[model samples]
Target: MLRAAAATHLRRHIITQRRRIATPESIRAVAVDPSGSLTPRAVDLATLRKTTGAPLRDLLNLDIGERTRRQRRACVLPRDKAVLLQLGGLTAVINADEALFFDNGGEERPRAALRRIGASVEFAFQHYKAPAFELAVLEAVLAEVSSSFQRRRDLYEPVVQKQLREASCEFDGFGVDGLHRLSAFDGALMSFEAETRQALQVLDELLASDEDMLGLLLSERRAGTSVDPERHGVVELLLEAYHRRLSAVAGDVAELRGKVQAATELGRVTIDLNRNNIIKFNLYLSMSAVGLAATTSIAGIFGMNLVSGIEEAPLAFGAVTAGSGLVGAAVVAGFHAAMRSQKSIEQRARHAADDREALTSLLANMATVENVFDDACRDLTRPAIAARLEAATGKKPSEREVEILFDIFDASHNDKISLREARSALHRGDAHPLIT
Candidate 1:
């Protein structure tokens, strides 16, 4: 009887345990702020533990603002003899005027920017195989970007242009109803924004997949890398694609900067032209004064008491007056020419100086472009750069130089530097040719 009773008790205990859900041994939580205003007062962990009943877990530094990102980790503790880890951005407080809310860990992290531009990467990769391939990989990449932009233009151009043209010339925004109707941009811009997001997602996927293959590609970056050279030439193609893409984007950015500088140059040129016009007006005014004085001389002679029959013969009087006016005009013009000879040369010198200054500014911009080009090359074609340097400089570089060059190639330019540009830059800097 005792043995049967003990067996029943054990069974009952098992049943009770099975029916109750065991609470986790430790519970942890973290907070994220999208408001940017929630700068928490500095908390002394020890004091907090003493003042409040809450246990001290860990401290995290975070930045939260409009388009800002913050990451936090919860306390690590054993739960039911097992580790329990929770990773996400669920605890966040967002506020108005912020463009985005990044909590809940849904948004991609910082290192994934490359993923945002995948179409460009694929377009750049066509150069992995034979050099004799019909299409220039660079051109192919540019065409793709152009196609994408053109597609966007087709969708939004008409609407934007129309709105810009038809918008009430009244630029006021204080009115209640009219303010609401104010133009931020063409309504099509919003539509494009949505499409851009979808395109970005697609690009992100492509880049993500490319990154998965990075380890393999990196290892193959050694001499004569080939993955089925007869077929895909996977790594080579991918590298070329990236090169083209970076170059194209960089070129666009460069072109925009160039245009801005050009506009500034134009403004300066206009000022100079206005100055020249002023000088020309001054000469015209001086000539006009001489003609007036000459006419007055004829009038003075005609008014003399011994005028005789000059006034009676109108035709002779007119001829003599005209001849005097012509001679006076010639004298004025000669004086003007002499004055111009003295000062115009000086004006030319000043204009030349201005031109020199403008040229210097252009050189500075070009230098910046050179740096951008070097960076792109390092990122897209490090091996090619390294090989080129080795052939030219005879003085073998240490691993550091090679590393530095590769870094320079990537960090210098934001896009691809053309072979001509790269070579010229080297020559300008007193560096040897890559091949020579």
Candidate 2:
């Protein structure tokens, strides 16, 4: 009896020593959810608005682990759950399996730390890219305007509407349509940033070539500037401004990309629409020909003198004339019937022509606007592509400049410049891009 009692007391003591588990109700519920990637675990960084520490980039690029070692532990509490963060260079992963702090008090493993950090960084990066892209696009556009203003005002033709038209023309992927698509937050922000920087460099060069000229054009809203002041060397001044502006605006590669895409889409849609119209026009043309044939047939019958006998008899002329009148009326009716069909067909053809012309005008106008956007975007990123094109073709300044100018023009290597290209290129760069 004494031994059995002793055994029972020992079992009770062991039970008392066991640690009691603690968890917030919310956390308990999270743990029960089976849909999470971490099937055996659950954590909510988003929920831990107050508890999560700042991004751990400091840990990511560290060649040595010393920096993270020196830093204090980052602890974040999402709702009722806490994340105890330890950094590995470039990652901040969570240790979801830990029910509580490891009782043995071992240092957090670096590998595990990295995975959590990566998850967080990926989240933050995903969030940051779109806003950054938007910001970059705006900056790029501003940069283009700045550079182009400098060119047109300081270096080249400021007064001519054509100059303005040219400056405003272009088509590239990143043009106006590009801006539309830029809201998509991809991790391409870095690429955008890189392209922007390159464009800025080119703009700097162009601006430096004629600072005074650029100053004037860029400040056209000049609180006090005269119209037709007739500055000496105005041609040179305009040239400088054009180059600077083109270089700057063309720097935003994304705009170029957007414009190109927009133009392609615009081209496809417009072409398809136009083609359909052409087919309709042809169908109408066939109808017109058929109507003309019928009209000709009615006129031919009138020429045959089908009721000449009535007109020949003078004594019976009045009655014959009356009968002839009936015959004439029949012929007139046939002519009118044929004429109506012919007229209808002709009218349809005219309408088709008018409709096509209107659509053509509209498409052209849209394309011009697209061109402007494309030109601006291409110019922003001109120098880098210039560099690439240069490298591809041995970097001859003349050759490179041509390639650069072509990019501004947004023309294919084989394609000649359109009025749109001319305007875009002219507005952005030297009006006399060609010496001729």
lDDT of each: 0.35, 0.36
Candidate 2 residue-wise lDDT at 379: 37
Q: Write the per-residue lDDT of candidate 2 for residues 1-436, one digit (tens) a residue.
A: 9999999998974553221112221121112111112122333323332332323332122211222123223221111222222211111222222112110111222222222323333343355542222112222223333433333322122212222233234222212322211222111323333433444444344334443322232123132454243432442443345445545544543444454344445545554666788999999999999999999999898967677565667688588679999999999999999999999978876754554343233222221222233333223234444443333323223433333244344555543434445555445543422122
Best by TM-score: 1
Cα lDDT for residue 89, candidate 1: 23
Runs with alpha carbons beyond 4 Å of true place in candidate 2: 1-256, 305-436
Candidate 1 C-alpha error for residue 73, in Å:
53
Q: In candidate 1, what residue range of length 10 has the lowest lDDT sum?
A: 92-101
What would the per-residue lDDT of candidate 1 be over residues 98-210, giving only the tens digit for each residue?
11212222332221111222222233334344221112222222243333333333323332333233332222221111111112221223333333333333334434454
TM-score: model 2 vs. ground truth: 0.20
